[model samples]
Target: MSSFPDYYALLGVTQSATTEEIRQAYKKESLRTHPDRLTKASSAEKKRATEKFQAVADAYYVLSDPTRRSEYDVLYASQPRRSQDPNASSNFFSQFANMFAGAAGGSGAGAGQPGTPPAGQRPDAEGVFSDVFEELLRPEVERRVSWWAYLGAVCGAGVGFIIANIPGLMLGAVAGNRLGAIRDAKGKSVAAVFNQLGGNQKAEILRALAMKVLGSAF
Candidate 1:
C-alpha cells in the first residue's frame, strides 16, 4: 500500500474539503468502482473494482468524521509519501475481513492469523448485523425497547415455551426483541442517525459492511 493512505486523494478531494464534499466524492467514487458495474469484466477486473470500491469507502469512513479527519490530518502531514508495496494490492480485500473482527468487538485475531476467515469465506454475519444495527442505531437513533419489540418478544417467548421449553423460550426472546427493534427503526432516518454517530461508531459500521460486501464478491 502507499505508506499512509491519502484519504483525501483516494476520494479525489482536497485536504480542506468540507464533509459534504467528501461525501459527494465518496458517492461518485463508489459508483465508479462498485463491482456491480463490472459485471461483464474478467474476474481480475472485477476483483480490482471491488478493492477500489472498498478503498474509496475506507477513505470516506475516515474523512467524513470530524474527529477522525482531524486525527488523519495530523498523520497525513507527518507521513511522507513512499513507493507502493506490490504486496498491498494482492490482499486489499482481506484486511477488513480480519481487521474489523477485533475493531468491531469480535473474537481477537489479527489479519492472516488463525481464526480469521480466508479470502473467499464469509465474515461473521452476526457480528456485522450487530455492528450495523446496534452500534449505528443504539445511541443516535433510539436505545430503549419499543412496545412492538416487547410485544413480539413476549409472544415469541410464549410460543417458544409451548413448542420447545426452556431453550426455545430464551432463543425466542432474543429473536423477538430483534424483530421488534427492526419494526421500531423502520421509520427512522438512517442518514440523520449516521450523522449523529461518533467516528469510531461509524468506522465500525463501515468496516462491517465492507467486509460483508467484499467477502461476498470473492
Candidate 2:
C-alpha cells in the first residue's frame, strides 16, 4: 500500500521516453521551477516551486540513470494506483530511500551488492545510445529532408535537381543510417565501454552529447 512518486508523470514525459527526452524535460522543468527564477514570487509560491524543483531533480536523478530507472520502472509497474498528494512531493526522496533500504535489507545483502535486475531487463549502453540518436537526431533529419523536399517542389525542376545533389542532405542521410547501424551492432559490453573511460570522462561525454543534441533541437 506504499505510495511512490510517478517519476515519468512528474517530469511530464511518458513511460517510454528516451534518456535524452527525460533529460530535456528535466532541464526545462528545473529551470521553470528554479527558486532563483521565483525571486519575485510570494512565500507560498516560492515554497511550492522549491518542492517541485526537488521532485523534478529526484525524477531526473533516477530516470537518467539506466539501472536505477529500470528498477524503478519495474517497481512502478507493480504498484497500485493512487492520487499523488502534496505531502508526497515533499517526502519523495525519503520514501524512495526507504524503499531502497528495505529492498537491500530484505535481500540480506550489503548496499554495495545491490541485487541484479531481472533477466534481459538491464539497460545496456547500446540501447541507451540508440534511444538517444533516434529521439534526438532522427526527427531533425526528417525535418531537414522535408524542408528540402518542399523547397525543391516550389523552386522548379532545376533547383530541385540541385537540392537533390546537396552534400548536407546526403550527409544527414548517412549520419542517420550510421547511428542506427552503430546502435544495432552487437557484442560490445556496457561494462567494457565504461571501463575504457574514466568516470568523469564518461560523464563529460554524455553531457557534451546531450548539450549538442539539445542545441540542435532548437
Query: Best by TM-score, which number?
Result: 2
lDDT of 2 by residue, 1-218 (tens): 35667878877899889977887786655545444344357888978766666666656656776666777778788877633443464455445554443233232111122222222222222333323234443433332233334443334433434567565555545555544445433344343343344444444444444556445211
lDDT of each: 0.54, 0.51
Error of 1 at 25 (Å): 0.8
lDDT of 2: 0.51
Off by over 4 Å in 1: 82-218
Q: Can you write out model 1's per-residue Cα lDDT over 104-159, one digit (the tens) per residue? A: 32222222322224433433322222332343345433543266789889988998
TM-score between candidate 2 and the true structure = 0.44
Worst 10 residues of 1 by lDDT: 106-115
Error of 1 at 190 (Å): 11
User: In model 1, how large is the Cα lDDT of residue 188?
Assistant: 51
Against the true structure, what is each candidate's TM-score? Answer: 0.42, 0.44
Clashes of 1: 0
